[model samples]
Target: MRAPLPLDAVLGLASDLIRAPSQGGIDTPVAVLEVGARALGALGLAPRLLDDENGQPVALMAEIEGGKPGPTWVLNACIDTAPAGDRGAWSLDPFAGVVKDGWLWGRGSADSKIAVASFCHLAAELAKSKDSWHGKLIVLFDADEHTGRFGGIKRFIKERRDIGGVMVGYPENDIVNIGARGFWRAKIEVYGTAQHSGAVSPVPKNATVKLARLIQAIDAVTPPPPPEGAPFPLPPKLTVTGVEGGSGFAMVPNAASLNLDFRLTPAFQAPVAQKLIEGIVAKLDAEIPSERPTKIAALESWGAYKLPADSQLGTALVAGASLAAGRPVPGEVCGPSNIGNYLADLGIPATCGFGVTCKGVHGADERIEIASIPLVWDAYGHALEKLLIG
Candidate 1:
């Protein structure tokens, strides 16, 4: 059919994206959206900037009406990039968008502006051959993927929910990923009676001390390992990422808090994980004097998501994509992705795949394979055609 997406053009688009600094949670992400919108507009589609009317998050949406009636297909890619950490660690200027040794080097090169570039490439090609498909293709330029709030998609779905399915783009090596592990977040407060530190002996009944001990107790409990020969593989994990409290340097703080981060497997959903944590607190409370008490409140939680074994999206990806890593070899081949996790919860048939995955995501010197750009573009087009034309 249409010529395979141009390798040079795809890389050129990625370079443009990498050149724009949309460091997640830091940079505003407007420039990247502008870049994507310009690219889509150049392809002769009517692209629109969508604001999150409920609040601050915003996204760019481009819709292409098919010649015939059918379900709407969505292609989504997050425009925000994780901040490039410690620039000195990178061999090149983190924002330079340097192309060297057959790779595109920059912070968002693979995590995941490349996927957005791939979406643009697919849209361009599809627009050139618009008659072959029968359904509308909606391309979403997600604006708040890495803001630590997941603001874009969350806002979008709230406004529109009749989507047939979403074709999500996130880095998952080269295979089409159909599932992802679970994640939970919480805040725990350890309370104590504030008193002058000078009057205290061994930090007597200190909230900070109580908080540290509770953290230690949590660390001591071993979660059950992934099942033997488990089809989908991921070990449970818990880490206390932050601790805060104390009103002043002169007194013992009355309340101290710890931020809980948990990465879970299907074996432990939110309630189960919450119960386990509660048990640990209860046991620790029994060992402590009644004067010191602790409480944990869940801030957010999401269970692991797996598409149906014969899911429509999964099957299409398996048959449609030609990956550098070879086709998806069964089992669960994925990591933590808000894209997969959210769609899976919506019971939406979504599959994530990309031609390349970068090194040191959320770190310095991120880069993606230069050649795989066109490869993934082709695969995305194939998947789109299969879903739209069939």
Candidate 2:
């Protein structure tokens, strides 16, 4: 039987990463990536940092090559984490890397830092027994993931072309995620006549009121259902994320804007959603004349994707998860768009989610269950063996 994963070492490394500040938009992630590089180096692998045009570290990569040639597999996880909100609400410091009650608590303990540690150790173990598997194993730690830039993964894909499949180390245990819902995001700006609040001679158009109407209209939209035989049915959804308008009480606001976030399914794609919103804006413009036509500026968008049940990546992952859990582990399509959606757009097969169980992600008091590490290690190891050894 294979030796058990280096649990203590993995936890220690995870704790070290957790102590580093890499909160998206708040802290620099390059520092955390440096820490990751050192950990990989400690595993007897030569890890290199990938930089963008600005010569800033965006990602870290370490490759373990087998003697025989076959498909290359990537193990990816983000080092950047969501901002620590309301530090006062936590029982301990969000960056303390506390291990208590069989849990590792920190800002990134559950989001993905732990996976970075786990993947590094797993790759090291595999390197020691390379004769058992063929092809190459790539361990990637990405930065700018939580910031929505995804500069790290984007740069990696743009520079390399031999990736066969990728497994994103997102926290979960019940299901092996096969796909994810896509998204169409935009910013709508509304214009109106500005005038003094006391002036009655020129009736001022209330931009806020118009924006409210638009919000109501969008809320009433019922997106089309998923494809007829979609194994994992995911419906499209729209939400008005933000609104900004009047500054003070005296003057009537001349401009206002609202952010629109629309989740997409295969049936309700980006184009269809965009056209629907355009039609709504036109209708609203004609009904209530504004100073300028309402403008919809497109933000980043990605298409939805779902892998077949028999897909090699998904099948192997499910089998591995089932073995680790001691029960049947189903393949699932996640509701939120993830890095897998980005890879899917490039026609690359990827498993979006599968890892240890965690709680309070992107929220206060985030922590990972320490006991779940062994099961996650086994699942990924078995899956890699199935894919590489075959």
Candidate 3:
């Protein structure tokens, strides 16, 4: 058997992972996976890499087998981070992976790679010691989470059915996140005919103007009523994220497009929201006839869910968090995350929201406090021990 990895080795691995430029669209998650595989193999565990249809490296699954019969517990963390915007604002190169002031500076430092490293470290240590645990320990490092497709988890679930519990290492400052808001994304496009500015002006039509009106009307649509038995305190909401139009400076643009992003309460289903959006677009189409016709396009839709606070997994996670934090941990649901949807749709009793306290996750100067890294590691170890091994 290999020796357990020391703290220095664990941090070193984390630092290396942070150094890898695994930003969402351009990230090579496989590079980070390779590092994890090396560390896991050194500790006698097996690591496997999985890819999506485009051969884009998506996730890593590492496993440690035990002889006893017990439920399998999955420890998952995303290996991708949002692109680093405006390098001038950062103290160090966003991909430099520098460590100073007891903090690790890099794109994936806090948003996720730290947790991935921590889980790998935990698995390596456990494997070395041959910890007399009963259940299987599965570590999943995913990509494409920041894009909100639940891509990696969705793929893993489809191929396997033995996952008994899941611990998502999202930054929650050790608090257990049992619920999250659901969301859907759509795009609306409008078409108009292009005519010379000198043409006779009987009825001038501008696609940009019509698109703006459609945006205003869609924004005015009332949100649906909350689900009858929903537990969360809020309702679904919508926001207009992007707009593009006008092809030339001299002539009125003949076409325009807008992106709609909606974050919904668990009460609403994706299909229902899609239908509602289609109806709104149909109404707009009727209102703005094709003197130049306009079209509404639905880009993508994802459902939302909220786990009851009283559920077994939810209560256990909270209890474990309180124990790890050495104080009472208050539970709340305020953010939109894919965790709830994954658990609800897959019928998996899972608890999420375990990681360091990080600000600027999807913003500039993104960093994870070096001090919080070890604390998060210890918290996850304690929580896993309590849930899977105890």
TM-scores, all candidates, are 0.91, 0.97, 0.88
lDDT of 2 at 378: 94
Q: Write the per-residue lDDT of candidate 2 for residues 60-132, one digit (tens) a residue.
A: 9998888788888999999999999899999899999999999999999988999999999998887887776
Model 1 ranges with Cα > 4 A deviation: 54-57, 172-174, 200-203, 229-231, 246-250, 290-292, 322-333
lDDT of 3 by residue, 1-101 (tens): 32333556766877888777777776656777787778777767788877787776677888776666777888888887788988888878888777787
Q: What local distance difference test score does each model get?
A: 0.76, 0.90, 0.73
Sorted on TM-score, best first, the list reads 2, 1, 3
Worst 10 residues of 1 by lDDT: 322-331
Give lDDT tens digits, candidate 1, residues 276-306. Answer: 8898888767776547568888998877877
How many angstroms is residue 349 displaced in model 1 relative to the true structure, after the best TM-score fit?
1.8
- Model 2 misplaced regions, further than 4 Å: 227-229
Best-matching candidate per TM-score: 2
10 residues in a row with least lDDT, candidate 2: 223-232
TM-score: model 2 vs. ground truth: 0.97
Instruction: List the candidate 3 regions with Cα displacement exceeding 4 Å.
Output: 1-7, 54-56, 128-131, 147-150, 197-200, 221-230, 291-294
